[model samples]
Target: MTDPMILSGTSSNLDSLRSQLIAGSEKVQLQIIPQLAELGNQGLEVIQEFLWQRREQTPTPVDGKIYQLLYSCGVPEIKDFLQVNFPQGVVPLKSEQGIDYIPLVELLAISDFQAADRLTIQKMCELAGEEALKRKWLYFTEVENFPVTDLQTMNQLWFVYSEGKFGFSVQREIWLGLGKSFESLWTKINWKKGNTWTRYPNEFTWDLTAPRGHLPLSNQLRGVRVIASLFSHPAWDNKK
Candidate 1:
């Protein structure tokens, strides 16, 4: 079996380091991203802190995996990072080669999707459409309220979604649509019922099916299809 990796930093200094990273400037030393990446659970906690604090500077831009981490934490830095680094065009989130601004989502959620990286967002919005971006965000909030059962479940949930395409599937697209009309839909629907099996709480209940140790994006598409069906159901759509 492969051994779990441990970070080199001391436990005592961890908190201070994290606080500094969270509250510190955007031009943080490049080393911080890797250190936090290696820090295991400590690193994740720091990432959350950074998202919550919503620092407005250039966030530590690590590889895209870190961007996925930030997204799971309700941060999406894709648009902002693209604008700042490549003012000439849209930067899609792909493999390690793609620009991964985990910080962009952070800026979007905190600023109501008004990105500091205006150029990229403006351009991408044209390509992906304002609604696609809106839907992407909607998925974030909807997933956030999902009953995780526990912190461990929550962690597992993040692992599945961040690593696999299933998490980003069709359910997400539907949720994104829902996000555009969140206040209205959320107000009418029974949030209590949102936790039921059919609503997608089942993904966690079943064994993770990430393909050959990798997340399949198709799974995400299927999930959205499911969500769309539910929303379009006769009962759900007919409600006054």
Candidate 2:
């Protein structure tokens, strides 16, 4: 049954929500829990895609089970799952497809964007850069199994390694400008998690549908370069 206060006005207190999920009728477990888990899985998939498109290095093999869980849970629930499992660290796994990307679409639907300008598409690649993309795939054991920082720089490094359009190691020199860190982008952009609202500047949030969230545009231009890089690296390409 739905929370009475939820209908009345309490919104949702995660602790209470958890209690209700566990204490509710056993039948609820048979039905509702699965749906909730699906939502969580969906959210994970969204983050996964974000990582892939923005990444500049080799694409890692996708895990099947994680994808399944995300396909079911959606975003908020997935966020909750991450909070429960990792608590302080980030969960960087992909699960499903459409569920996570939808939020970005919803954000864009509210406004009008042109297909030709390519403004939205370019903006997204800028967000992922290269260093951030690299760090996402890097199996870092330090920092308690979490990325310490320099996400943007790591992604840029990936771009250089991949020969992607933006990975200008010496051309644009944006990486040189970041000094030594890329996670600073988090600080540069100013994002935050709120109860129900995400204010821009102070915070920014979007789903997979938005131009900024989409990665194919950038990937299409650079994927070939990355693939070539892979072939050149005999060790990686020849690994058995």
Candidate 3:
């Protein structure tokens, strides 16, 4: 695993890396891609074949990694595949407060939905000011102060990477579509099931098959005000 993670690429290791990619743990699979890329065309050929194998299934975070790596590899065929299938391009990390959203983008790109969700909360708290960042949550008033550009940028990272399945904007759309009904929105996004709230970690679907707008979860536990403020945010008003 250590070798695959950091080794200089060589022709002899090409087949070995390919085999590791096919059967390796997610950690290995992800780490080995750079090693694979280091092998040049030989490495890229492996990546191309690997990507083709997963073309039918939903794109994973590894798919996002490949999308970025392929651009660096200078392969026309792979780049074309990216242009068609992953047209979201690189998500813009716009932030009025100069917050770094690259980590959020990276997590989303790898399809690490839960990590992204956690980071989403962190970023929102960051937007709310230092006290909120220290407390790790938001007051509804703080939500109103969130910069529209930052929110839209965060939403784009989640929305585009998740095949349009998730994001705060998607949640806002759901909220508006239901005539701004919060209870209905909860049920629709699977945040609640009948009388009971879905338990975190155990009940949330953390993947593409989860209900639409089910992710990038706002701090809904403090009641609907936070999410309500988020849904009502002017971020939705601006045209991208």
lDDT of 1 by residue, 1-240 (tens): 543342333564576667666556544523465467566666766654554344343222322234444444432353454345533211222322233343443443232122323322332232333574564422323333322222122122223223232222323333555673533332223221354422333232132332221221212323443335333433322221
Quantify all predictions' global Cα lDDT against the true fold: 0.36, 0.31, 0.78
**Reference-based TM-score, model 1:** 0.25
Which residue segments of model 2 deviate by more than 4 Å?
1-79, 87-217, 220-226, 234-240
Give the number of the best model, judged by lDDT. Answer: 3
Model 1: per-residue Cα lDDT at residue 234? 39
- Stretches > 4 Å off in candidate 3: 1-89, 219-222
* lDDT per residue as tens, model 3, 53-145: 787665455665665677556678877876775455455466799998877766765678898889889988888888998988888899898
Instruction: Estimate, for each residue in 97-186, the C-alpha lDDT of model 2 and write its tens digit.
Output: 211222222222222122211332333333344553444321112212222122222233222212132222321233235563333322
lDDT over C-alpha atoms for residue 73 of model 2: 42
Cα deviation of 109, candidate 1, in Å = 15
Better of 1 and 2 by TM-score: 1
Better of 1 and 3 by lDDT: 3
Q: Count the clashes in each prediction.
A: 18, 34, 1
Prediction 3 global C-alpha lDDT? 0.78
| Stretches of model 1 off by over 4 angstroms after superposition | 1-9, 55-240
Q: Which model, 2 or 3, shows the larger TM-score?
A: 3
Between candidates 2 and 3, the one scoring higher on lDDT is 3
- Candidate 1 lDDT (Cα, whole model)? 0.36
